[model samples]
Target: MFKNIKNDLPASIVVFFVALPLCLGIALASGAPLFSGVIAGIVGGVVVGGLSGSKLGVSGPAAGLAAIVLTAIATLGSYENFLVAVVLGGIIQIIFGFLKAGVIGYYFPSSVIKGMLTGIGIIIILKQIPNFFGYDEESAWDLEFFEIDGGNTFSELIKMFSNINPGAALIGFLSLAIILFWDIVLSKKAKIFKVIQGPFIAVVAGIIFFTLTLGNETLSIASKHMVSVPIPEDLSSFVGQFSFPNFSVIFQHEVWIVAFTIALVASLETLLSVEACDKLDPDKNVTPTNRELLAQGTGNIISGLIGGLPITQVIVRSSANVQSGGKTKLSTILHGLLLLISVILIPTLLNKIPLAVLASILLVVGYKLAKPALFKQMYKLGWKQFVPFIVTVVGIVFTDLLSGIGLGLLVGIVVILLKSYQNSHFLHIEDNSNGKHKIKMTLAEEVTFFNKGAILKELDNLPSDSYLQIDLIKTRYLDNDIIEILEDFLYKAKERNIDIKLISKRGTVENPESFINFFKEKPKSNISLS
Candidate 1:
C-alpha cells in the first residue's frame, strides 16, 4: 500500500484540502456540531480507508445525507438520538454485506453513473458560488428547500450579487487565481511545485492573506468566511465537544425509520461513487461492489458510534483524490489521519484558514469533475448514451441528485425495454408460388416474459389463409407465455384455413399438444431440430 508514497503524498494533500471544507459544509448543512464533521472526516479517511478495497475511492461525511441527518435530528428530538440511528444504519449496512447485497451496485447503468457524477459536479459548482463570493449565510447549509432566509439557490445568487463581500470575493478570486496559475503555470516550471499541489498553495495564500489582514484593523475578513471548526484551548475541552448516541431510543419505530433512511441513502451514494470512481480511474479497475458495501457498513458503524455523521464513499472527494494523483488507498488513509490530528492539535491553525480559500479549492474541484470535455465525450458516445447522460445532468441541475439520476435511469430502462421488445421476435413474409403469403416467424435467441406483448401483437396481426412457417432453429429457450401465444396463433390459423409449418430440431410437426410437450420429447438441455 505504501509502495507509491511518493506519488501518493501529493494526492493526499489535494484530498485533504478538498475534504476540509466539505467536512465542515456537510456538518453545517446537517445541523450537527461542527466538530462532529471533522471527526467523521478523520474516521472516514483513517478507519474506512484502511479497510476499503477500492484503490482510489475516498470516504467522508457525505452531503447527500445532510438533509436526511437534519430531518432525523428534528424528528427524533435530538442530535444524540440521531447518532443512534447512524450507528444502527451502519450495522444494517454491515448486514447488507453479509447478505451479499453489495451486488446492488453492479445493476446501475454506466450512463446513469456518469450522469450522477456530472450532475454532482454541477451541484458542487452551484453550491460553492455562495461560499466563493463570501456570502456565508448560516442557511447555505440547507441546500434543499428555499432557505429560512427566504431565498432558494437562485435567490441566494441574486442576493450575492447585491450583498457581495468585497473582502471575501477578493480573497476567493485571488485564491482561485493562485490555484489556476499553480496548475497551469508554476507547476510546469518545477517538480517541487507539482509536488506541493495547487490547492495547498491556495490555502496557504488564504491563511497568509487572512493573517495579514488581521493586523490591519481598517480591513478585515469576517469570521463566517473563515474555517469555523471550534478552537479548543486544551485536549479535554476538544474531547468534551464529541456527542455520543442516546441508545435509549433503540426500540422506537422512528429510530428504525431514520436508521433505514441513513443506511439506504448512504449505501446508494457509496454504490454510485464506486461506479463513477471506476469511470474516472485511469487504471480501469473494477471494484468489488459487495466488498465496498461491507467496507462502508463497517465504516459507518464506526463513524456513527464516534459521533460522526453517516459515512459513504463520496465521488467529490474520491474524484479529487484521483485527479490529485492518489494512486492507492494509503492517500485516503493519510488524509483521515491528517483531519484527526489537525482538528485536535492544530484547531487554532485550522480556525485561521478562510472558507473562501477552500471554496476556491472546491471551485476547481467542481470544474474538473464537470469539465467541458466530459460533456463533449458523452455527446460523442451517441444519443442512446448521450440522451440519458444529458437527462441525468439536467435532472440533477433542475431537481436534486438522486431524483435526476432516477429520471435518467428511468429513461435508460425504457430505452432498454424498447430495444428488447423491438428485438424480441418478428415475422418476415415472402410471396410463394403456392399463391400464399409465405410467413416466417423468427424467434429471438432467448425469449422471456417481457417479449409476450410483442409476440402476441405480431401473431394476432397475421393475415388469413397465409402459409406460415414457425421457426425456432435459432431459439435457445421459449418462455411459457410465448409458447402459449404461439399455440393460440396456430388455432387461429386453423380457423382461417391457413397452412402452418412448424420448424425446429425436434420435428416438423404443424400442430402439437402444448408448446412444452412439443419441444420436450426432442432431447434434454441442448434440444435441437434436425
Candidate 2:
C-alpha cells in the first residue's frame, strides 16, 4: 500500500482538503455538533479504509445521510439518544455483510450508475457555485438539491448572484484558474506538478490571498465564508467534545426503527459508492462489496460511540482520491490522519483557508464526472441505454441521489419489459392455394411471465378456420404462467374450428390434452414438428 508514497501523499492532502469542509458542513446541515462530523471522517478514513477491500474508495460522513441524521436526531429527542441508533445500524450493516447482500450492488445497470456519477457531478458543481461566488447563505458542504434553509437548487444560485462577496470571488476564480492551468498545462510539462496537486496549491494560495486582503472591507472574505473547525480552547474543552450514547435509549422501539432505517440507507449508499469508485479507478480494480459493508459497519459503530454521525463510503471523497492520483488505501488512511491532526493542532490555520478555493477544486472534480463527451457516448449506445442514463442524471439533478436512481431503475425495468413483450414470439403466416391460412408461432429461447401477455395476444388474434402451429423447439425454459396461457388457448382454438399443432423438444402432438400433463408425462427430451 505504501509502495507509491509519493502519489498517495499528495492525493491524501487533496482529499483531506476536500473532506474537511464537507465534514463540517454536513455536521452543520445535520443539526449535530460540528465535531461529530469530523469524528466520522476520522473513523471513516482510518478504520474503514484499513479494513475495506477497495484500493481507492474513501469513506466519511455522507451528505446523503444528513437529512436522515437531522430527522433522527430531532425525533430521538437528543443527539446522545441518536447515537444508540447509529451503533445498532452498524450491527445491522454487519448482518447485511454476513448475508452476502453485497451482491445487490452488482444488479444496478451500468447506465444508471454512470448517470448517478454524472448527476452527482452536476450537483457538486451547482452547489459549489454559491460558495464560489462568496454567497454564504448555506454551508459550503451542503450538496442537497433542496436546501435545508427553504430554497431549491436554482433559487439559491439566483440569490447567490445578488449576494456575491468580491474578495471570495476573486480568490475562487484565481484559484480555479491556477488549478486548471496546473492540471492541463503544468502537470503534463513536468513530473513535479504530478507530485504536488493543483488543489493543494490552490488551498495555500487561498490562505495567502485571504491573509493579504484582511483589512479591505469590500474585498476581505468574512470569517463565515472560510473553513470553520471547532477549535478546543484547552484539554478539558477538547475532552468535553466527545459524547457517549445513553444506554437507556436502547430499549426504545423508536431507536430500533431509526437504527434499521440508517442501516438500510447507509448500506445502500456505501454499496453504490463502492461501485462508483471502482468505475472511477484508473486501474479498474474491483472492490469487494461485502467487505466494504463490514468496514463501514465497524466505522459507524466507532463513530457513533464517540458522538459522530453514521459513516458510509462517500463518492465525493472517493472520486477526489481517484482523480488526485490515489493508488491505494494509504491515501484514504493518510487523509483521515490529516483530518485528525488538523482539528487538534492546526485548526486555526485551517479556518483561515477560503471556502472558495475548495469550491474551485470541486468544480474541476464535478466537470470530470459530468463531461459533455459522456453524454454523446451514451447517446450513441441507443435509447435503451441513453433514456435510463439521462433520466437518472436529470432525476438526480432535480431531486436527490436515491430518488433519481429509483426513477432511473424504474425506467430501465420498463425498457426491459417492452423488449420482452416485443420479442416473446415470432409469427409467420402462409396462404395456401385453397385460400386456407397457416400460421406459425415460435417462442423465444426463454419465456417467462413477462412474455405471457404477448403470447396471449398473438393466440387470441389467430384467424378463425386456420391451421396454427405453436413452436417451442428452441425454448430451454418455460414459465408456468406461459404454460397456463397455452392451455387456456386450446378452448379458443376449438371454438374457432382451427386445427392446432403443438411442437416441442418432445414429440409432435396434434392437440395436447393438457399442456401441463404432456410435459409431466413425457419427461424425456424429444423433437416435435408439424
Candidate 3:
C-alpha cells in the first residue's frame, strides 16, 4: 500500500481536502454530532483502508446513508440507541462477508454501474453548484432528491443564483482555473507539478483568497461559507468528543431492526462504491468484494463504538483519490490521518478554507465521471447498453443513488429479456430443386424458456410442403420447454408435409420423434450453469 507513497502522498492531500467538508456535511445532514463524522472519516481511512483489498476505494460516512441515519436516529429515540444499531450492523456485515454475499455486486450490469457513477457525478455537480455560488443554506452532503426542508435538487439549484457571493465565486472560479491549468498544462511541463496536484494548490489558493479579502464587503468570503470543523479547546475537551454506544438497547427489537437496515444499506453502498472504484482504477485492479465487506464491517464497528455514524466505501473521496493519482491504500490512510491531525492541531486554519474551493474540486471529479465522451461512447454501443445507462443516470439525478440503480437494473433486465426473445435462433432459407422452402434454424448457445415465444412463432409459420432443419450443434444448454415444443412440432410437421431433420451432438435423425429423448442423453459439454 505504501509502495507508491511518492504519488500517494500528494493524492492523499487532495483526498483530505475533499473528505473534510464532506465529513462535517454528511454528519450535519444525518443529524449526528459534527465530530462523529470526522471520527467516521478517520475510522474509514485508517481502519478500513488498512484492511481492504481495494487500494483506491476510500471508506467514510456516506451521504447516501444520511437519510437512513437521520430517520433511524429519530425512530430509535436517541443517538445512543442509534449507536447500538450501528455496532450490530457492523456484526451483520461481517457475517455477510463470511457468507460471501459480495458476489451480489457482480450481478449489477456494467452499464448500470457506469450509469451509477455518472449519476453520482451529476449529483455531485448539482449539489455543489449552490456551494460553488456561495449559497450555503443546505449541507452539501445531502444526496436525496428532496431536501430536509421540502425543496428538491433543482429547486436548490435555482435558489443558489439569487444567493451568489462575489468573493466565494471569485475564489471558486480561480480555484477551478488553477486546477485546469495544473492538470492540462503545468503537470505536463514538469515533474514537480505532477507531484503537487492541482486540487491541493486550489485549496491553498482558496485559503489565501479568504485571508486576503477578510474586511472587503464586496469580496470577503463569509465565515458561514467556509469549512466548519469542531474546534476542541483543550486535550480534555477533545477526549470528551468521543461517545460510547449504550449496550442497554442491545436486546430491543427496534434496535435490531435498525441494525439490520444499516447493515443491508451500508453493505450495498460499499459494494457499489468499490465496484465503481475498480472501474476507475487505471491499473484495473479488482477489489476483493468479500474482503472489502470485512474491512468495512470492522471499520463501522469501531466507528459506531465511538459515536460515529455508519461507514461505507464512499465513491466521492475514492474517486478524488483516483483522480488525484492515488496509487495505493496509503493515500486513503494518509488522508484519514490528515483529518485527525488537522482537526487536532489546525482546526482554525482548516476553518478558513472555503467550501467553494472544495466544491470546485468535486466539480472536476463530477465532470470526469459524467464526461460527454462517455455518453457518446455509450450511445455508440447502441440502445441495449445505452438504455440502462441513461435510465440509471436519470434515476439518480431525479431520485437517489440506490433508487436510480434499481431502476436501471430493472431496465437492464427488461433489455436482456427483449434481446433474449429476439436472439433465440438464426434462420436461413435455401431454394431447393423440389420447389420447396428448405429452412435451416440454428439454435442459440443457451436456449431458455424466455426464447419460447420466438422459437414457437417461427415453427408455427413454417410453409407447407417445406423441409425444416433444426441444428443444435453449438447449443450448450437447451431448455426442456424448448425440447417439448420441438417434440410437439414434430407431430404437426407430418400433417403439413414438412419433412423435419434434427442435428446435434447426439447424431442426426432424418425425422426426430422426440427432442426430449435426444437431450435427455447429454454430453459433458452440454451443461447449464443455471
Candidate 4:
C-alpha cells in the first residue's frame, strides 16, 4: 500500500478535495447536522481505509442513504434516536460479514455493472451542471432524477440557463481548461505536474479567482456558491460538535428496525461499490468483498457513535481516487486524515473553495466513466450485453441508483432466458446422393428444460420417411424433460416411417428400443459416460 508515495499522496489530496464538499452536501440533504457528514467522511477514509482490502475504493456518507436518513430521523422521533439505529445497523452489518453475504455482489451481470458505472457517470455530470453554473439551490450529492423540490434532473438543467452566475462559470471554465492542459500536455512533460494533480491546481485557481474578484459585482463568486464547512470557534467549540448515540433508545423496536434497514442498505451499497471499483482499477485489483463488509461495518459503528451518518463505499470518491492515479489503500486513508486535520486546523480556508471548481473535477471524472467509446465497445459485444448496459444507463439517468440497477438486472435475466429458449439443437444435413433425406441434429451441451420447446418444435417438423440421427456427443447433462421429449419423438418416428438413430458417448443405437432404457445412469441423475 505504501509502495507508491509519489502517486498515492497526490491522489489522496485530490480525493480529499472531492470528498469534503460531498460530505457536507450529503449531510445537508439527509437533514442531519453538517458535521455528521464530515464525521462519516473522516472515519470512512481513515478507519475503513485502514481495514479495507480494496486498492482504490474510498468510503463515505452516501447520497443514496439521504432519503432513508431523513425519514428515519423523523420516524424515530429525533436525531439521537436515529443514532441508536445507526449503531445497531453497524452491528448487523458485521454479522452479515460473518455470514459471507458479500457473495451477493458477484451475482450481478457484467453488463449491469458496466451500466451502473456509466449511469453513475452520467448522473454525476448532470448533477454538477447546476453547481458549475453556480445554482446554489442544488447540492452536489443529490443523485436522484426526481428532485424533492418538485423539479427533476432535466428541469434543473432547464432552470440553470436562467440562473447562471457569470463569475462562477468563468472560474469553472478556466479551472477545467487548466485541468485538461495538465492532464493532456503538462503531466507528460514534467514529473512535478503529476505530483501536483490538476484538480488541486484547479481548486487553487478557483480560490484565487474568488479572492481577486471579491469586490466586483459582476465577477464576484457568491458565498453560497462556495464550499460550506462548519467553522468552529476554538478547541472547546470543536469538541462540542461531536454527538453521541442515544443508547437509551437501543431497546426501542423502531430503533432496531431502522438499524436493520441501514445495515442492509449500507452493506449492499458497499458490496456493489467495491465491485465497481475493482472494475475501474487500472491495476485490476480484486477486493475481498467479505473483508470490505467487515471494514465498512466497523467504520459505521465508529462513525455513528461519534455523530456521523452511516458510511458506505462510495463510487464518486473511489472513481476520483482512480482517475487521480491512486494505486493503493494509502490514498484512501490519507484522504480521511487530511479531512480530519483540515476541519480542525484550517476550516475557514477550506470554505473559501468555489463549488464550481469541484464540479469541473467531477465533470472530468464523469466523462472518463461514460466515454462514447465504451458505448461502441458494448454495442459490438452484441445485444445480450448491450441491452442491459444501455437499459441501466437510461434507468439511472431517469430514476435513482438502485431502481436503475434493479431494472437492468431484471432485463439481463430475461435476455439470458430468451437465449436459452432459442438455442436448443443445431441441424446439419448430409449430402443425400442416394436421395434418402439423411438429417442430423446435434444437441447442445447441458440441455435444460428451457430448450425443450425449440427441440420439440424441430422434431415435429421432420419430414415423413426420412433417416434421422440424434447427436448427443456434445451433450453433457440433458434434463429429464428433454430426455422425455426425445423419448416421445421415438413413437412419432415410427408413425412417420422415419429411421431413428441415437448417438452418444456410450455407443450408437439403431432403432433404439427405448430412450428410458438407454444409459440407465445418465446426466442429471447417474454417472456421466464422459
TM-scores for all candidates: the values are 0.92, 0.95, 0.95, 0.95
Clashes per candidate, residues 3 or more apart or on different chains: 5, 1, 0, 0
Alpha carbon lDDT at 31, candidate 4: 94
RMSD of each: 2.9, 2.6, 2.4, 2.1
Write the residue-wise lDDT of candidate 2 on 325-413 in tens digits.
99999999999999999999998999999999999999999999999999999999999999999999999998889999999999999
Please, what is the whole-model Cα lDDT of each candidate in the order they appear?
Answer: 0.82, 0.90, 0.91, 0.90
Where is model 3 poorest over a 10-residue stretch in terms of lDDT? 521-530
Q: What is the descending TM-score order?
A: 2, 3, 4, 1
Cα misplacement distance, residue 487 of candidate 2 (Å): 2.0
Q: Tens digits of per-residue lDDT for model 4 on 11-57?
A: 99999998998999999999999999999999999999999999899
- Pairs of residues at least 3 apart in sequence or in different chains that clash in candidate 4: none
User: Per-residue lDDT for 300 in model 4?
Assistant: 87
In Å, residue 201's CA in model 2 sits off its true spot by 0.6
lDDT of 1 by residue, 451-518 (tens): 88888887778787788788888887777667667766766777887877777766576654544468
